[model samples]
Target: MDPEGSRIQDDPYIQVMMAGSTLRKVKSRSWKKNRYFRLLEDGLTIWYKSRWAGRGHSTFSVTDLEAVREGHQSEVLLSIAEEFPAELCFTLVFHGRQGNLDLVAESPDEAQAWIQGVRKLIHKTQTMDEKERLDQWVLDWFHKADKNKDGKMNFKEVKKLLKMMNVEMNEDHALHLFTMADKSESGSLEIEQFVFFYKMLTQRDEVWKVFQDYSEDGEKLMLEELESFLSVEQHEGEQSTQHAQELIECYEPSETAKKQGAMSLDGFQMYLCSQEGSIFKPEHQDLYQDMSQPLSHYFISSSHNTYLLEDQLRGQSSLEAYIQALKRGCRCVEVDCWDGYDEDPVVYHGHTLTSKILFKDVISTLKEYAFRASEFPVILSIENHCSVEQQKVMAQYLRQILGDMLQTTLLDGQVPQQLPSPQELKGKILLKAKKIGGLEEYLDETCTDEVSDEEEMANCDAEMASTEDSPEKKSKAKSKMSRELSDLVVYCKSVHFGGFEHARSHAKCYEISSFSESKAKKLAKEAGTDFVQYNTRQLSRTYPSGLRTDSSNYNPQDMWSMGCQIVALNFQTAGLEMDLNDGLFRQNGCCGYVIKPDFMRDGNTQFSPDKPEEREGYKPLRLSIQVISGQQLPKVNQKEGSIVDPLVRVEIHGVPQDQAKDETSHINNNGFNPVWNETLDFTIHTPELALVRFVVEDYDKASRNDFIGQYTLPFTCIQPGYRHIHLLSKDGTAIPPSSLFVNISISELT
Candidate 1:
């Protein structure tokens, strides 16, 4: 079961990849050069080099790759398809915001070999368990330290390895351990010996102490003793005996220990680091939330300016951005459509330097990937800046590309009293756009020519956004709308929001409103209860302010607190805001729709984000987290001889009253095995609405602290016990073996 063992011994594709091939790396139409690309011996990295850059090789791990798409799937690859055959080209799609690498092989066979080989490697990486990942991580470091390619290391190399792993060990102690590991009287230690030495050097004394507290003997724990540990430390309660038995049978490495109903230290550690031992509840990892509720009752995962890859201004607009957003479980994607060349429509940020993407191409991409991550309905939030003619073209593209997946008519052939549930609208694309009149009137008329003040204001505001004119002045301007495009609006009709009071009396359940971040925050603060009540009846979207030209995102939790169904954030931006959004939607199978808390969904219920104490059944929680230790943390600066002084911070984002953070003291000169053993506590007034974020940063006395890694999950998902918090990179990809060991306990505030 070794991660790097003889698993791929018979795989011909992998063998060919290891042999290497010269491929034409295509960056653009004209920039194509031959490069020698090969998979590293470890089978986890791809190394490539050009003759132009002598002795300078670059490598990327298989873990960094998101997918391997065959043929001309990328824009760069598509540009060169006229010269290169489809079978001879492939794309390496990297995770996060990394640009995709398009490559063309010498022959079709070489292309297929790389594609299949990379696919196999990706599958292996994805399917690896936590323990396997840890072993592979250790092996990777071993490969790095064995610089001479001898598969053996001497005391000198071992000492250097210690420093590389962020451990500044005493020379005497290091040599003593090295000698102890070299049992064969050999001057150099092999891989096995190196692993033994690593175990000795990085022993978890804290875990051993906890094991000693429960075990009658230092070596093993009997069934009853194991049950006691589960109940007392893990809070397993009545299920402790069963859970203990399961852990022993599953994680016990020794057959003798399993037969004797005894758990060894290895078994205990394995159980502690397994998925069952994770900080988040394993039961909540799937679609466990109620999805049958009306669409307005759920906080739908959404994206603002989905066409842009970077900042709104001067950012390249691409169809890949739409695909990425959809694949990340973003149900609602905003497309700012403007007039394009050749009587077609384009999507881009209006009045900015952002590049344009074909509206048809975006639709095709949406059709292909809309339900790939989540089967919930996708909302195409159209910010139309197109002329009436191009708008018609846009509508035609939507129908042609999306086909039956597009919901062009009302459900059950009638307008609903309330919006349909996500379950009912699954696998469908609903257009959120302006229409000529009400749903009934639009349904009856073939082409109604009307000048609606709401549609006029929306169109004018979008076109004249750069102007310093007020809302009143923006409303005075008018624009024409094509009936063909207007007919596509079914459930989600875009309308101008006049105030909470006006909405209470005039807004229909089928009608929706979009608010800028500033206005939404104002509404949430000035009239929280009304905002929540309004959302319970009608869908409301809160987007980033226009001033965020750099495509920064606002705190989505603030809008979410007021039960805004679509709190859109710039999906292209990566920060605390996107982290919070990902954390909230990470649960319920990441289906992009999370059911709002009970009070927030009930129109009659008077609940405000500012006054969680006044809500019915409000039970405050006392959360205690002991920041025990960190393991194999990444260096902030990946340079030789650099080490991080890491610190842990736990933040709770929710209602203003529940929002808080606490941090442990910094552990200097240690990124690996830095032990804090400090407890941080918080009182969450609204536990269901709260998100807990665990952040590791490199502490600095001078300047700002450098971010190491972070993990954020819903507060309700926090499991009470000794758990391992696996850290993720800023882009939300797993950084295996880099984790925090913590003890979490949550109880009702008495």
Candidate 2:
């Protein structure tokens, strides 16, 4: 052993090497037991044995020692206690053989010197590129200094470093240094850290006091105290949330409306006004008042009376039930009509045995019930369930009774001449052609009659053809001809069919026309008729079309554009009951409904209730909706003669309100306005409701607006899930349903 090695004994952890088998003996207070260490081949290999066990316990290869000494071995065993006294017993071994090696000292000055040493050594090793070597050097120094391995330099380490430099620091000053040095958590301080900390110390009185009062003997702060302080702050935030919820639940009436049921309209208005961050203005109050008006002009009287016309004959159809339904606010009604024995029109769904009740009877009944000219212009869709002759007779009777009130091509003054025989009519409803020869002949005769006699004769000879011939030839010729004839008389009206292409080749042609299920909707839109008769199957196929062709298959807007009123035929009471029970009536685009009386009596099915006296309403549901604009606003000073443009309106029904009256609850808040040209967001406030309905209308001519769509917003006051909702409109209403929900969860930490 070298003589100078004996002085290491005083350090209490020195090992003495021995010759013969290359063994060592260690003596120290920390190592109580005798420890053997061996050096073989002139210190080329070293080994140690536990003297108590008399066995070789650990060994060290000199080759590795040489490598580490040469800076080739990446691992650098660091004594953590030198920097962090709290981690005195721990030692961190860094992998230095992989790349650059770093040694972290207690002070920032020492750390800078250590980093410089690492940079110089790495540049000499050629183990990494210039950029990579710099990065490795910085990372290694940070890792050595991060005693807690939290990737941050804390106060204790900084204070210890200052003490070594003969500079004292109080806890606060140490903490400030820790904060400034560890801006990004990595323990080692950068060039900016020293400058920032020094500047802060010079500028702040607190920092200077902390530096002057620094003491190593001062008591260490307990970890529990730090954690408790953080917890208290977080708890206060949670309490605030609970308090807000309580406030909403225990809301009190404002002082302005304390005397009026505690919830007067004025109070509601105030509440709406108090809502800041909203776009609604006070001027929109009228819009809300207007929204309270009835969404539809017609109401079904005796909504629960399924047997209103069970025993009435086809001609003696009574409007007593219809009137009651209207009083209840049904805008549309179903009236069955049949032909009498003498070709008179009668109102009944089934065949009539007597002709006592003429179509005039029903007309008069309607006139009495209607009362005012514009109060409630109800649409009475007549379902033709009897023969074609019966329907034609009924139509004719209706024309005579209704006169101008009846909306038809004839009423519009579009007739070319006198009505044609029923048998000669084709497409849509069966009617007699007043002037035919189709388009070709009509055009020729009407336009050529003014020509000179010579020109007229020349054209007549070339155009003249046989009028009477074999039945097959006549039928074929008739099929090809597209003009009106001079002598043909009215016979039977033709029934329109959706599959007319197929029916023309198979089914016998009739004088009366019935609508085909396939084309009924398209034809109705084009004709602008208020009443359309369709087979039950077609009517039952209430799949939406046009609006969302990608899914709904039907667009209410398209239907509204077509002037035809929709009616379902062959509907049994059971089917109607099913529809009502399933909330089918709530679908948009449906104007009126029809069902055979016999179906109503089969099982005593009743109409669902409309008011509180009725059964519970269906669950609230949402509809996926899309809105479309039908017309553009007129420019300034534009012509006023044209019909006024319609404004979109929405009315919700079946919501539980404070009042028990059968009045509508208008959502007049700016949140419901469609003119904003942006989405209006709001919540529906109601409790345990039976049914939810949406009615849309225009403000100018309220009665003339169409029911573009309807939907039910499902009723679940407090829940976590998705619910679809649709917008409602009477005429040209285009807003789609807005989806809403509440999230009750903590924000995620990045």
**For model 1, which pairs clash?**
none
- Scored by TM-score, the top model is 1
Per-residue CA lDDT of candidate 1, range 1-750, in tens? Answer: 263546773589999999999999988898999999998888898999996787899999999998999998987888788899899999899988788888999998889999999999899988987667767887898899987989999878887788788876678998999999999979889988888888887789888989999998799999999999999998888988888899998888899999999999888888887888889889888999887889999999999989999997899998889888998999999888888999988888767788887888889889989999999999999887678889889989988889899998877887788999999999999999877777867557654554565556653322234243245325334667788888888888877777778878877898888788787887777888898899899998888877788999889999999889898998989889999999999999999998988988898979988988998898888999999999989888878788899999999999999889999999878888999999999999999899999999999999999999999999988889899998999888788778899999998888
- Could you tally the backbone clashes for each prediction? 0, 86
Candidate 2 structure quality by residue, lDDT tens digits, 101-128: 2222333433333233223332333343
Name the TM-score of candidate 1: 0.97
C-alpha local distance difference test of each model: 0.86, 0.29
Query: Against the true structure, what is each candidate's TM-score?
Result: 0.97, 0.25
Instruction: Identify the leading candidate in terms of lDDT.
Output: 1
